[model samples]
Target: MRRSLIGGVLLAIALYLGAGTLLFAFQRSLLYFPQPRAIGGPDRLLMLPVTDQQIAVTVRPLASSKALIYFGGNAEDVSRSLPDFAEAFPDHALYLLHYRGFGDSTGRPTEAAILHDALKLFDKVSALHSEVAVVGRSLGSGVAIHLASQRRVARLVLVTPYNSILELAQRQFPIFPVRWMLQDKYESWRYVPAIAVPTLLIVAERDEVIPRWSSEKLFAQFRSGVARREVIVGAGHNDIGGRPEYLSLIRSGI
Candidate 1:
């Protein structure tokens, strides 16, 4: 019985190490959900030069001084949101990022790469427009928090935002050593404290992906006077944008 118990313990330890190794190797695959552009394509696709590669962006360009840089959810094609955004803010210019591997962008997606691309997009837009606002949804909220922390953003909006992807992964895989295993931690909590711009956090009343606690925790991290939280009644994590109040709240923030 003692020998059997020893064998079982060793087997469990081996499995744990193997699982962690696998998680580290293909972690980005789990974190990013890339999709091709929908239908006929965007109004205008912008090519951005970053390091050795060029990333793509869908632009609803306007000759305006105020612009909005939008980062979309995992599995979302940001080009689809352009029409609605164009109608909502007719006077302002819009630039929707097609994350590294998604849409027409080249190369694999990673947290570090996405964040770097976001900064590049902002800088490019800032030159053409005097004021630049940022809006990020779901997984993209993680990108927005990091961008806001490092840049001087005019306005910031996060829809279905979470405190950190690491916390969510830990909750979902309670048995696994997510802290040590996961690669793209996306700890938005570490970035929120530095975001000083007037920010709005929109939550789904029934967000199945992100817990309400996660949103609340992130909201609480923002500088006292710079943050606002709004919940759309009867909305889910993905359907928040469909609500009439969604655009209204976003317009009010900017």
Candidate 2:
């Protein structure tokens, strides 16, 4: 009987180690959900040349000094938002990025790659427009915050933001050592203190993906009076864009 008990313990340990190995190997697959571009044509798309890869940006061209750059959620098709943004901000030119591996962009999505692409896009846009506002939603919030820390953004908006992707992963996979294995930490709080531009955080009252506490934690990281938080009543993580006040709040922010 003691032999059987020892054997069972050994089996459990082996299984746990195997699971950890698999988690570490394929962790990025769980983080990025690449989606195809649903809208835009050759005329409306801008092919941005990066290091050995051409990134696609859905653009609304307007000859203006004010511009808006948008980063989207993991599974979002950023092209879909172009029409609404064009109508709302007629005076401002719009550029919405398709992350690496999403839409027509090439290369795989990673924390470093996405942040690098964001900086490239910002530098290109800021060169054309004197003032630029940045908006990011969900996973893209981390990318946006990091870019804002490194750039000179005129205004900033984050929707359904979180303190860090690592925290979320740790909460979801409590059995795994996520802190040690996570390749893309995306610690937005680390960049929030560096943001000197006016910022707005749009939160969903009933966000199921990112907990309200996580968003509040990120908000608290901002220097006092540098950012404001707005909650959309009866909104969830995925459906907050459908809320009546969503675009209006964004308009106010940028």
Candidate 3:
């Protein structure tokens, strides 16, 4: 009986260790759902230097002094956003980033790599434009929050944003130690206090991914008078773009 009990204990420990190893190895893979280069036609795609490889950006370039830089969701194809943006902001040049591995961009996706690329992209846009507005949705909210805190962003908009990927992950995988396993924490709450630009946070009325409280908590972290949080009546995490109020809020913020 003693040996059987000892064997069961050992087996449980081994299973736990194995699960942890797998979680650590493929954490980023679980987070990033990369899609193929969907923005067809040669003219729509633009390449920019990021490390050694040319990162793909969906550009709606105009000879305008104002530009808008959009960082999409983790699994988003930014090419789809071009039409809506062009209709809304005709005078502003539009740049939508496809993260490494998401489109034609090379290398694997990582938080450090995406943040590095965002900084480079923002610098390039800033050189030619006077006022640059930034929009980040879902996962991109983390990138946008970080960029707005570091750079001179004119206006900031986040759709279905979270306080941090860490907190969200912890809630999703309650049995696991997500805080220890996660490689990309994406703690937007940390960046909120330093952000000085006028900000708009659009929340889904029924967000099935990011909990409403998580966004509210992040909104609360913003310096006293810097941000306004609005809710879209009938939208979820992915479908918030379809809401007319969502676009209106974005237009007003810009």
lDDT for each residue of candidate 2 in 1-254, tens digit (9 for 90 to 100): 99999999999999999999999999999899999999988988999999999999999998999999999999999999998899889999999999999999999999999999999999999999999999999999999999999999999999999999999999999999899999999999999989999999999999999999999999999999999999998899999998989999999999
Tens digits of per-residue lDDT, candidate 3, 129-193, equal 99999999999999999999899999999989999999988888787888888989999999889
Tell how far residue 252 is off in model 3, in angstroms: 1.2
TM-score of 3: 0.97
Q: Number of backbone collisions per candidate, in order?
A: 0, 0, 0
Question: Which is the winner by TM-score between candidate 1 and candidate 2?
Answer: 2
- 61-137 per-residue lDDT for model 1 (tens digits): 89999999999998899989988998999989999999999999999898889999999999999999999999999
Task: List where candidate 2 sits over 4 angstroms from the true fold.
Answer: none
- Sort by lDDT, best first: 2, 3, 1
Query: Which candidate would rank higher by TM-score, 2 or 3?
Result: 2
lDDT, candidate 1, at 179: 92
Question: Residue 250: error of model 1 in Å?
Answer: 1.3
Candidate 3 lDDT at 251 equals 89
List TM-score per model, in order.
0.94, 0.99, 0.97
The Cα error of candidate 3 at residue 104, in Å, is 1.2
Worst 10 residues of 3 by lDDT: 35-44
